[model samples]
Target: MSGTDEASAREALRSGDLTIIGRIRSASNATFLCEATCSDEVVHCVYKPVAGEQPLWDFPDGTLAGRELGAYLVSTALGWNIVPYTIIRDGPAGPGMLQRWVDQPGDSDEVEPEGPDLVDICPPESVPPGYLSVLRAYDHVGNDVILVHADDRRLYRMAVFDVIVNNADRKGGHILTGVDNRVYGVDHGVSLHVQDKLRTVLWGWAGKPIDDETLESVAVLGEQLAGPLADQLREHITADEIEALRWRVGALLREPVMPGPDRHRPIPWPAF
Candidate 1:
């Protein structure tokens, strides 16, 4: 969708009649594929109700929907547009997060690296030199695969975004390739935590210098975090969480480099 269409879709999600069409069987929470209508404009959306959220010891109960919205706000503020338009409202299952559905043709084969050598599913040797491998994985048939995501700049931008938000559950499955071929990150319910817990599949740029453009975006986001964005985020997340977000952004700005994996477990389980 065009920028204008997306803005209109965001509005429709905020003030539309959301009708559940089907349920997405998720292991963590109840998610619904929905259609939202407003003034004859219909848009597909994903609805996650607060009541369906499974409680976690690390995160407080019933706050997942709010965090989903919080991630969208952060993405918008940074001008990254990594996450889709999302809002918190009352759904059939009560209060929840409603995010505009990204329509992709189908899942793309993700690239993964297996140790020093890239997996040979598609002949990694054929891939040009200097290509950075993002992650390692096994195909449905259990064959090894190595993904080279650096060719797409959107994936890199999303990796930077994950650092800013402290996203703890950035699994490969959460990354969607839209019809427009843009990489979109979803399932951000476990983000914006008060402590450091960034688990992600986009770790190909570890220890690399942050580009000037990305650094500038980070600066703008840092400024917004202290202004109107901060005000809006306080409505969804705790003050401590907001403070932690600010700290994370500041840390990235200061370091201005991609970090290596955490000393503890860095990649999420079932990475894909």
Candidate 2:
């Protein structure tokens, strides 16, 4: 997004009037497609109301919206801009997390289809040469299918950001190519837990060394946590969770590389 568009998007999400357009039926939570209007600025966005969130065994009820906002703040602090512009405010459905919607290209569902969808599943032999194979599995009919993601830099940075937030669900569909052609991640309600529950599909960079630029971003994030970021996060997550975030950043800087996946439950179910 351009500078003016970014400013307008933030304004719309912060104090705009939100009108429910329709429900995003495929979402696990009660997510709605909304039209946010502020003065003359308007944009379509995704709104997930606290009242509509499903109770999860691990996360406390009604806290998902705050977590989503918290994740956005951390993303901004890191300067990765992985998450879209988001905020916690009163909507038509009550209070919720509102984020500017990104427009992705129209494409086919075929294994080798086109456009900005970086992650896909295809037959083992048909996997794209430029993509990194993540896992080998089977379809309902038992045909072989391999989950793969592109060897792109933007997506790689998102994977690093996911580690910092301890994102619990980073499915393939959550990774989108924005209208600006930047890679973005969404659906962060289950992120930033005190415990390590980092399940995601972007393990293509597993065990790779972190680049200097990304390490610098992580270091900046650590310093910010000591300043204003800590205070900002305290509003959404528990003090313990924020501390865990600090530890994660420090540990990453010490290691300076992408992490290997946990043999147990490394990826989210329904991978897409």
Candidate 3:
């Protein structure tokens, strides 16, 4: 996709009073992030096409439509900003989803990186200490960086969430440091796994044990799971599916880790 395609899509979105303005750029799939026409808007308008390529994981029947809907539903329910916003209609690319684009920190007018996302500064051991604090803050409740303290409790909670979701790509780069220096995690295309695909650097805190704050957060999520969250997931996903999410969250809250294959110690090669 190109700027022309984004511009046309942005026009359609604004015609509906979506408030997206300025030049639009296609970051990935059918999604575009554009400057907000209104002042005091901290977020960029995100748009996604209704149809696109199938993801790496196989959904219920390997259906593209079903998979897209599933991604949107689960991410919203979990309160994790995964799939971009969607607009259902005919477009230059045919029917698709249009969502608010994720604001990335880079030269806005320049060409953005098209290669695999950089997860951390080269050499994990060499990462600066402040960035680690940024990662811890990203998973917390507050957007105010000063109000948020990077402690053990929040890290354990995020790790449990990653574990239950079977998050395959929690690379350091996937976590974003916003203008406030408060971290925000993105790119969860490979979560809620049926296989053993938990790959993350967060395991370093494994033996450190869970804290009260994380336990309380898990309990809150568990309670939400059976109510509104369950209702939300029921629309696009299976009842069993919602139950599985609840079970995973409960299991993690109850127990920290499961026995793993000895070979799991070695990190994936060419670590992304």
For this target, which candidate reaches the highest lDDT against the unseen true structure? 2
Over 69-139, each residue of candidate 3 has an lDDT whose tens digit, in order, gives 44455444455434444434433445444444545656466746453232342233334333332222221
lDDT of 2 at 267: 97
User: In model 1, which range of ten residues has the least summed lDDT?
Assistant: 113-122
How does candidate 3 score on lDDT?
0.48
Model 2 alpha-carbon drift over 4 Å, by segment: 107-116
Whole-model lDDT per candidate: 0.82, 0.90, 0.48
* Each prediction's TM-score versus the true structure: 0.87, 0.95, 0.59
- Answer with 1 or 3, whichever has the higher TM-score: 1
| Residue 24 Cα positional deviation in candidate 2, in Å, after optimal superposition | 0.6
The better candidate by lDDT, 2 or 3, is 2
Q: Write candidate 2's Cα lDDT for 41-88 as tens digits.
A: 889899999999999999999999999999999999998889988888
Candidate 1 to truth, TM: 0.87
Give one digit per residue, the lDDT tens place, for model 1 in 1-272: 58888777877899889899999885469999999998878999999999999999999998999899899999998898889888889999999999888877543346432332211123344454655676566777876776554435787889899988889988867887777767789999999999889887677788889999998999999999889999999998999999999988888888889887864668787675
Query: Considering summed lDDT, which 10 consecutive residues are worst modelled in model 2?
Result: 107-116
The numbered model that scores best in TM-score is 2
Q: Which residue pairs clash within candidate 2?
A: none
Cα TM-score of candidate 3: 0.59
